[model samples]
Target chain A: MREQSRGPAFMRILYLEDNPLLAFHVEQMIEDLGYVSAGSLSSFAELKEKFQSLQFDAVLVDIDLVDGPTGPDAAAWLQKRGIPAIFVTGQAQVAARHHDISLGFIEKPISPSDFAEKVELFRSRSTGS
Target chain B: MPIVILLDRASKPELVRAELARSWPRARLIFYQRPVTAVELVSGVQSALLVRLRQRDVRDHIGQEMELRRELNHRVKNILASVTSIFEMTRRGATSLDAFTDDFRGRLRALEKVHSAVFHAAEGAVSIGDIATLTFEPYRLVGQERISFSGPLMNLGRESGTTLALCLHELTTNAIKYGALSQPEGRVTLRWSVIDGVQPELALEWKESEGPLVIEPARAGYGTRYVRSALAAVFGRLPTIAFEPDGLRCSAQGPLSRLSATDSSQPR
Candidate 1:
């Protein structure tokens, strides 16, 4: 969370998406909204090995990934790493189970307004204190 | 009412009447002294017995028809649910109106193809090998040697069969678009074998070669995503897809308890 609190504070977002097309589309969406895509990964096992190297202020996770239902675990992993995360997924009920760990969720076929609002919310969260 | 017991000409009437009355104690027995002809029997009380038996037969037939109707209704509901799920999931990844239409229709066709295979199957389960054949049939028509699959005679449950069919459809679609089957010299091999342990597992491997060199893309495609979800949902495990410099390779394994009734999914 404090990564963006530093000098020039770019909102670098690491996305946990297994679908390359969706990942590419969402990466474009993130960049179009004036945020940097730190990188994208397909599974939790990959995230576990590489989270330290990726330079990102926050993470955008989907509830289901290539490695089964491990998005909740990813969110919890980010939380423990002192980073904030948000779920961008179609499985509302399953994501809600781990909503406490993530700051919020942005649903699939992501609405631009919702995407902007969530990003603002995440940024404001870092500046508040 | 006196219950009459007809005695053949060879039998004495008094003795038969006594025996019948002893057995059917609540009814009075009246034994006839002479044997009746078939014509006489049809016109007598036996006609009433024949009518009752016919009525019972009609009732049994009706019961069987009702049972068949209920089963057909249940199967129709299952098909509807399965189609709806496939449509909903496929709709999520489509890029344009045309893309969505084509993708959705293709997926439905895949489901329809698998349904026909299942219908013609002699046993309750469909063989995995048949599903692979149906999925790659279009490519095979072009060049028989271009694509080949070999697997054990593993049978899958109806739902699992549908899931596997859809997964194979995605893989075949990808191979046609960008993988090994995209060129004349390219080829794909899909092979599987059951591994025995505390639990038997079905291992599937899809390998491609002899085409353009492959590279991992910046993002995954719809086919990859569908295969992952369908496999995970059906097999309770995720497939490993590696984009090697030479070609693409994918492998996954899960317990046989998912589809087979017993461990008979493995080769004998």
Candidate 2:
């Protein structure tokens, strides 16, 4: 089991999930695991419009959004900006196809352990450590 | 060359022979009347029809199976996601293992029962009356009825019904935990109706009364948040959940078209 706390550096996570319940649930889990929740947006469009103002260490994206299946495009966009994006989705196959853009994929119904482990990768990628 | 022509008994053999002779010259024309065996013809036609029917049945079954598979995949993923959320929320609220188990199981059972009702509904749509009765059924005693629901005949499509069910579950849970249903004298009333007009509108309300003094929580929890978000998603309008001194009252209204299964188009 991962320790409850990882020093002072709280990784701020921005998740893109269209489903409001899942978004809220994951948001709570993120906080419970001692991470900062940057907030959640339902569509890639919202992310693009609000990206610059939001403060976050990395992103967790779902494949399908309110607008369309633009999770891959969002990941690529974040990658171009030097931000690490990890996919959290039920469609693992679709996320795998875009592996070059994302740090990795966390399959949905995300357990706290799996999420905490994979989310640590974002920290390493962001800090170049 | 001997040219033999079998003509239907009803047809003129002479005319058909002339036509055949015109097409094929230097032919000794030998004409034979077509045999009329009704039984043989009927059986032959019946077998052909049976083969075609079997082919159609197989084709339809394959198509239906594929469609059902797609729907099942979608439903399973959604249900899993919901269950995960319920588990997380219940864990957050629980103070002990028993509490966690009780809360989680109750929520899950509510979801399962509501889904079963919606699925088994013959028309693929469940009326609001049925939703109310089914949702509150587990809580009711054999003789004493503490909770009551009244509503006009209003049907909801699958998505809307599920959303409503979840919201109702949250309300029912909250009532049991802290509001009306927490005490023997406490009571809950759920009422709903649709007002007919150029743009029909649906109105629903849940009221709790004769309970411990209602104190609004400092912050909204999973139940309130879920109710707010789910109702807004289905109705295109957010509901008002007020914690009054007397009791808790939740009310919402939106276009009826959005809630009904037959019509999903948003009112313009």
Q: Largest lDDT belongs to which candidate?
A: 2
Model 1 stretches astray by more than 4 angstroms = A1-129, B1-57, B141-144, B262-268
Chain A TM per candidate, in order of listing: 0.89, 0.88
TM-score of chain B of each: 0.70, 0.74
Q: Where does candidate 1 chain A have its weakest 10-residue lDDT segment?
A: A1-10
**How do the residues A1-129 of candidate 2 rate in per-residue lDDT, one tens digit apiece?**
133434425688888876666876877777776778776776687789878788987889998765567888999999889778999988788899988999889988887789888887876654556
DockQ of each: 0.03, 0.21
Candidate 2, backbone clash total: 0
Clashing pairs in 2: none
Count of steric clashes across candidates, in order = 3, 0
For each candidate in the order shown, give its overall lDDT on alpha carbons. Answer: 0.73, 0.79
Provide fnat values for all models in the order shown.
0.00, 0.35
| lDDT score, candidate 2, position B268 | 14
